[model samples]
Target: MDRTVEHYERIAATYNEHWTYNPDYVRGFSHAITDALRLTASDAIADIGCGTGLYTRRLYEDVRPTRPILCVDPVRAMLDQIPASPGLQPLLAEAEDLASGRVALPDGGPLDAILLKESIHHMPDRRATFDGLAGLLSGHGRVLIVMLPKSIQHPLFAEAHERFEQLQPDPTEIADMVAAAGLRSSVSYRTFHAAVERERYVHMLESRYMSVLGEFSEDELRAGIDQFRHSYRDTPLLRFDDHFAFVKGWVPAR
Candidate 1:
């Protein structure tokens, strides 16, 4: 197994631990999804790839009581950490497993809104993943995909995409896959701001990024990560408003 993948799998527990408790990231992400989808009281939503249920609690708050929301992820450790709620249910499944019919809702229904926040890039096959998502959609279901574009050129974005490209997928490729999934899709561009002191932004970038750099012994990678960290440490708080985009689509009713 690739050490990076194994590392992520092992750190899944840690990711859950930190992310689930972070309110700022969760609220911002949920608001992004809700805004993009124009979520209504009648919507039955499923947050696909809901790691650690970071945004699931927000989903519970933002979505209406009349609508049932399902949280799905393949990582049990991540899902298990989430406390249960009245309308919230967690399914242990991958993005490609959405249509596997492994998870059944109490009401025997399909999803009206599906949120793929920051998780779409992890799928081995974007096209297959969309197909699975389409299969699980209710007639009026909309799938909202939050993607961080590759050309952003920020150090963290660039480093992440360099490794991601080796996996052979890009946001544009995902948009194309969404079209091919036989859904009507459109994209909205938006920005997310990080409110941090200049030094805090640097620390945030370095501390989080170094974890990934540990995988490589290449002096260039090491140097690049460090240089990026130094250049941004006192520069300014990162706006992150550039790399964010969302694609919303609907599966035709059967």
Candidate 2:
């Protein structure tokens, strides 16, 4: 139980509303999770921190349903947002809450996929969390953790980037944490579509993640976002480059 997840538990309800689902974004990111899992019948996959089923619904549409897909999140409010679908099993459980042996499968086996999308940073104990995940995986199970880089490399985000730098995890540190979990895995990255749009991107940032921006004083937040906008005010929408990298890997087969 890390403080990160606890923080998410507090904001889970409004999180999804802030980041409206861009199907194109979901498809681009989820491709790796699906490709790594190589889903087929007889396989069960769980989307950890499956908030509002954004990616879950995307997976439901894109991937071939070989087995039941379980959507797991600690907050019930987030779980309640997931609309039911064929073979979609939405469960209310935090990352550390999966030890319940009662979780079942159609073939009475274990899970084949576990996706920790942008959720690992919030966790306090990475090793303990992954260790628990290892026990839940079937022989071929893989865990894919998707995340953004710690640094805001763009000039428009100078102030916000400064704060992000204070809170974000280092790549090497995160890699070391994963290795300490005693799992066999590899990491990869992909840039997001935001890599292209600066002004609209900043606007989206101001509108969508206001809570995150609001964490600072109103004057500071406004000054930061306003200055961020000014940095890109002359920048064209499509000309602005914003790429978010997702680090993905898997636990080797048992």
Candidate 3:
């Protein structure tokens, strides 16, 4: 199993719960997605690595798209969490499948929008992936990538930040990749906020809410949490900024 899939499997049950703790963050990012992807009435939309359909469900509710909203993910465990809905279609395929033509879209031709929120980094060969996705776009189709910066303001242990910086892809570089793939590309930034009870935030850290936290050993996690307790300002609510880098690519309308 892919290590990321394994990590999602371990946290699949709690993955949906992950959103509840950051309702504002969810709203901000989802709104940004709708605007960036212009999803008010997209004919066909796909959310690659649509983890448990947390954001997919939100997008569905907000946009109420007429056509099917495809939810794609490689991990069956995570894909299973997206409940049956009128317009939600769950596909068990990795991003590479779409890139390599191994998996076909419903219409087998064009897609109005393709989303790679927080999942682009997991794609092993992004250049080819971008090339393939660019080919899949309808006349007015678009691909939007939402990802993290190298550093974050979240109250994680110091080492977790280091690990994230090592793994996180620079958004400008990804935008350049899109341009090199022969599509019009642009890069932008969006910031969101999360306010949760301090204990809930601590639990999130313990749950290893992100991949960076997954790297810590059990003892290291405990120590990190302990440090967080001591170091973070003693307060009922934990508030922090979440920074998202957006890279958008599209084929010009023909």
Candidate 4:
């Protein structure tokens, strides 16, 4: 398994314990998905990397789609967090599963809205994966990929910061990939101002909340957090913008 996926797999059960999203931040992101996808009551939705269905459930409520929503993820444990319910179907698979025809949506039709929230960077074959998605879109459908810019603003331990920049792709390049797949693509930005207790934020680091943090050894992570504490001791409340690059792709009107 890919290390990123492995990271999630190991942390699946306690996923919610690692971090807490500001309720306002979640609301903003949910709104961004609805607005960018221009979702409708009848749109069949698919959340490709719907970990624990945290946002998926919220999104389901906001869109209130009449068609069944497919919540797909590679980790079975993470998928299990989403309870079986009316209008929701959980699929244990990766993006490649859909692209390679190994799996099919329960409804067996093109999707009207596709979401890849915080998970686009995990795909090994971006071009091929997106080409498949473009082909799967209904005429009026849209795929909204939520990713961070290659560079980010969140304060991190020095080495962790450098490692994150190394790993994260430039969101602009992803937009280009979407265009190359023959879809009309546009990029937008969203920012969530987070104010959290400094120690609470540090615990998120120790939990390896960010995948890049997983690359660090236990001792290294301990040391890194120690350094962060020493440097940020005076910062009782850590304030930063949780930034997002919203990349939206759609089949243009014929």
- Number of clashing residue pairs in every model? 1, 8, 0, 0
Better of 1 and 2 by lDDT: 1
Q: What does candidate 2's lDDT look like per residue over 1-254, in tens digits?
A: 54444445555566665446454656765675566556555567788878778777777666757766888777676677777777678877767667434444335547777777767766666767767776777766666777666765555356666777776676666666656665565556556554445655555565434224545665775687777667667766543334444444456544
Ranking of all predicted structures according to TM-score, beginning with the best and ending with the worst: 4, 3, 2, 1
Q: How much lDDT does candidate 3 score?
A: 0.85
Off by over 4 Å in 3: none
Cα lDDT of model 4 by residue, 1-254, tens digit: 77777888877887765444577777767887888888888898999999988788778888888976899999988998887878678999999889777887776879988999988888898889878877788888889999988888787889888988888999889999999988899999988787878888797887777878899999999999999999899999989888899999998899
Better structure of 1 and 3 per TM-score: 3
Q: After superposition, how far is residue 189 of candidate 4 from its true place, in Å?
A: 0.8
lDDT for position 108 in model 3 = 85
**What's the lDDT for residue 226 in model 1?**
70
Model 1 spans > 4 angstroms off = 1-5, 13-25, 102-107, 153-161, 164-168, 197-225, 236-242, 252-254
Pairs with steric clashes in candidate 1: 191-241
- TM-score of every candidate relative to the true structure: 0.77, 0.78, 0.95, 0.95
C-alpha RMSD by candidate, in order? 3.9, 3.9, 1.5, 1.4
Residue pairs whose backbone atoms clash in candidate 2: 2-124, 4-122, 192-244, 194-242, 195-241, 195-242, 195-243, 196-240
